[model samples]
Target: MPKPEHPTDPDVEISASATARELRFHARPEVTVHAEAEPGGECAWGSDRTNLPDQVEPNVTYRDIRIDFRVAAALTDPTQDPSSP
Candidate 1:
C-alpha cells in the first residue's frame, strides 16, 4: 500500500474530551465522521462534545454528536450525480 498522506479521509480527527478537578465524565462516545467543505476542498471531519447527562455539578456542558463512516467517494463517476442515491 502507498504511504498515507498527512491528511487523509477523516482527516481532522477529533473526539470528546475534558479535564478538571471535579470532572465527572464518561468514556468518549463513538465518533461521527462527516463530509464538509474546507478552505481548499471537501474532506471528512468529526467532532464530539463532552458527554454529560445532567448539570449534576458545577462547570459542566451537555451536547450532541453525529456519526457515520461510509466508504465516501469510493466510486466517483464523472457522469453520475454525487448526491443522487
Candidate 2:
C-alpha cells in the first residue's frame, strides 16, 4: 500500500435553522466517518448522515467525526524528477 498524501483544507460552514441543523464541508473526501458516543461507552464508526437532527437535549456530549482525503501516489512521488523533462 502506498502512503497517503496530505489533503487541502476543506471549507466548513455550520448553520442552524428552526427545523434542522446542517454542517457543510466543501470538498470531496475520500473517507468520511461519524461517531456518536454517550458519557462512557465508545461510539463505533458509522456512515455520514445527511439529515442530522438539531440538538434538542444534551444526552450525548462526546462525538468524533473524521474526514480523510487521499492523493494519488504518482502525484506525491519524490523519486520522480520534475526537471528531467
**Predicted model with the maximum lDDT:** 1
- Local accuracy of candidate 1 as per-residue lDDT tens digits, 1-85: 1221323553344333343333433544554545544344434432222343422444454445222223222223457665689
For all candidates in order, the CA lDDT equals 0.37, 0.30
List where candidate 1 sits over 4 angstroms from the true fold.
1-8, 23-36, 39-51, 54-85
TM-score of 1: 0.21
Per-model RMSD to reference: 11.3, 16.3
Q: Per-residue error at 60 for model 1, in Å?
A: 8.8
The deviation in Å at residue 30 for candidate 1 is 23
- Tens digits of per-residue lDDT, candidate 2, 9-84, equal 2122122222223344443335443433332322222122233322322343223323222222112225656467
Error of 2 at 66 (Å): 14
